[model samples]
Target: MVAVALAGGLFTAASGCAAEPPSPRERLIQDLKTEPQFKDYSDKQVECLADAYIKYAKPEAIELIMQGKTPADSGWKDGVDGRTLTRDLAACNGPIAPSPTG
Candidate 1:
């Protein structure tokens, strides 16, 4: 019985550690909803920001944005003005990345 209980605990711990992290899209929404600065953004605004970040920012920049850091001056390029992108995202102005075919 002791060995069985110990094995069960080990399995639980291992599974807990192995739990998958949230995908970028999920993380972006979570950040927008949970971060004090971004909490007031509408759902559409949050979606835009998430889409823009997923399409533009590098991993480090994404982490920073998730932490409530502004993207301006972060040196993360999106092929659009940083401030404009942020404003557009806040306004839900279609942050979808442009197609490469253009």
Candidate 2:
């Protein structure tokens, strides 16, 4: 099981070329599929965490979290309770195909 992080933001340079990155929900799932710690988690767990993160966290904070930081450590706690997501993730079993939304 792992912690959840969520988000979305806009950024602009002096030239006014602004860009919006993928949703926090998107990033978390990407991490779960790619990042070392999360890659091995079941799709159910990733999906569960993604939903929780979108409901509770800031997207930008996910980078630090992927680096092994917790929602509390990165101070991204908001929306749903972190404990609930953690418990849900722990219950999910995976590494299977036919992913949640892949």
Best candidate, lDDT: 1
Worst lDDT run of 10 residues, candidate 1, spans: 88-97
At residue 64, what lDDT does model 1 achieve?
A: 73
lDDT of candidates 1 onward, in order: 0.72, 0.63
lDDT per residue for candidate 2 within 1-102, as digits (tens), equals 122222212222334665779776777788778866676676777787777656556765666676776655545555556687666555555443575878
> Candidate 1, residues 7-92: lDDT per residue as tens digits?
99999998889668889898878777886766666687678778877766677778776676765675466465778667755556
**After superposing candidate 2, which stretches have Cα over 4 Å from the reference?**
1-22, 63-73, 78-82, 93-102
Candidate 1 residue runs with Cα over 4 Å from true position: 1-20, 67-73, 78-87, 93-102
| Poorest stretch of ten by lDDT in candidate 2 | 1-10
* Steric overlap count per candidate: 0, 6
